[model samples]
Target: MRIDKWLWYARVTKSRSLAQKLATGGHVRVNKDKISSASKTVKTGDVLTIALERRILVLKVVALGKRRGPYEEARLLYEDLSPPPPPKKHAEPAVAVRDAGAGRPTKRDRRKLDAWRNDT
Candidate 1:
């Protein structure tokens, strides 16, 4: 199956066109070989390396789906090999709060805010 079609059928991308763009844009690799065309064929057991926003996915194809299916069905198409994402760190809350009706900060207010930001 074409890489783009497989990606779409596997529910990796929202559409086949986006899969094509991703493949042609150099964000996809098949069996460690970079694929420059969306028409590249993929089969069972081929490892796919896909780079998505905020995370990289490594998947081993287990099946060639005939249609774009539900998430449950799609889950059976590939084996995820990517590591879990790191936990998020809690950040300190903002120290300053203005009234809802407050207008733009004055120069003096700006200075105070800058000083407060620097202190943290």
Candidate 2:
């Protein structure tokens, strides 16, 4: 089954979009390498490493759910291979940077900024 679907059906993530976004952002791993697509196929015995909040979840696929099911049934889909990692050690959230001279950017300013950033 597709990794994202499995995640959703297994109740690992609340929604498929969240799962896809997490995968595409390099937060989800199969075995050890990052995966960036919801359609990536996974099978029984495959190990998945999921990074969430401040912890890492290591799971082994025990079965594939053919469809979305009840929470208890869904939990049967995978086995927790390792306990979640300890919460990140007192890390402060990154602060957002604001442009010094900007008093609310205009549409043209936004376009120029987009072009400049996308040029790379």
Candidate 3:
């Protein structure tokens, strides 16, 4: 099956055109070989490395899909081998706030702010 069609059928991309772009733009690889065309053929057991929005995917093709199907059906098309993404750490709130249009701090104010910051 064509890589683009397989990607669409597997639900990796929202549209076949996007899959084409991804393939032609050098973001898709098959069996460690870079594919520069959407028409590249894929077969069962071929490993694919796909780069997407904020992550990378390593999948082994399990089947050549017959049609664009539901997520459950799509899930059967490939075996995911990518590692889980790292957890996000929530940043702590700012220790100080300044209102809009606030002018630059005076020398004394700067010293006081520095002292407060150091104390924390």
Candidate 4:
């Protein structure tokens, strides 16, 4: 099967056009060799490395699926060999407390700012 078609059927890409773009953009590799064409043939047992939006994937082809099925069925087409995703980072608290477009500081605000600065 064509590499792009296989990618779509395997649920690697949402659409065949996107798969074609990915393959032609030089983001798809087969058995460690870079493939620059969407028509590249892929057979069972071939290994694929694809760069997606948020993560990279390494998959070993298990089957050439007949149709674009549900996620469960599509998963059977390839064996995921990619490493686990990194843990999410925690959000940091904002440093600046001033609101936007608040205008210049008043006398009291200046005194508070001076006090806050001296303490810091």
Candidate 5:
């Protein structure tokens, strides 16, 4: 089966054209050799390395599917060997909590504080 077709059937790519671009753009390798054509033939047991936009994927072809199917069916076509993603980072630290009435003082509270300060 064609490499692009296999990728699509295996659900590695969302569309056949994207798969074709992946192969032609040299983002796909079969058994460590780069593929320059989308029509490259693939067989069971062949290992594929695909570099997508966000992350890389390594899958071993288990079967050549007949059509584009649901995720469950597509998942059966390959054996994933990719590494896990790194942990996500946050923009800021966790928020700090304060006791009740510890937030902002009201106008009356401020007047009382002023009176206490003046008396002292």
Candidate 6:
């Protein structure tokens, strides 16, 4: 079971091209080392660490798939080694503030400030 095929068969990615892209872009790792080749075979019990979106996934191969299949069948190809960690909360960027110690505003800043004052 090649890594890319397994990934597709497992429904981890939508298409083989996407899987190849991810692998080639150094997003997929085998035993912690990045693997770019899609043809790399993965055996049962092999651990894979994949980076998708914002989080990393750790999975263990449980079975080999000879062909791509339905979602239910594909899921049997691998076992999630560990449950994904909860998403970390991200604070929104703080609004920019003028530094009072700047002494004086630039011409543009003054105009903007005037507009803000008018709006208020």
Give the candidate number with the greatest TM-score.
3
Query: Residue-pair clashes per candidate, as listed?
Result: 0, 0, 0, 0, 0, 0
Q: List the residue pairs that clash in candidate 4.
A: none
Per-residue lDDT of model 6, residues 17-102, tens digit only:
99888888899888877897888888888899998996788898889888889988988878787675888898864533677798
TM-score of candidate 5 to 2 decimals: 0.74
Give one digit per residue, the lDDT tens place, for model 2 in 20-40: 888888888998878878789
lDDT of 3 at 31: 96
Q: Clashes in model 6: which pairs?
A: none
Please list the C-alpha lDDT of all candidates, in the order they appear: 0.95, 0.84, 0.95, 0.93, 0.90, 0.84
Which is the winner by TM-score between candidate 3 and candidate 5?
Answer: 3
Residue-wise C-alpha lDDT for candidate 4, range 6-118, written one tens digit per residue = 99998888899999999999999999999999999999999999998889999999999999999999989999999999998988644436788998889999889888877
- Model 3 C-alpha lDDT per residue in residues 5-93, reported as the tens digit of each score: 99999999999999999999999999999999999999999999999989999999999989999999999999999989999998876
**Whole-structure CA lDDT of model 6:** 0.84
- Report the lDDT tens digits of candidate 1 across residue range 1-120: 999999999999998899999999999999999999999999999999999998999999999987888999999999999989999998866768788899989999999999988997
TM-score of every model versus the real structure: 0.75, 0.67, 0.76, 0.74, 0.74, 0.67
As a whole number from 0 to 100, the lDDT of residue 1 in candidate 6 is 74
List of clashing residue pairs for candidate 2: none
lDDT of 2 at 102: 60
What residue runs in model 2 are displaced by over 4 Å at the alpha carbon?
Answer: 84-120
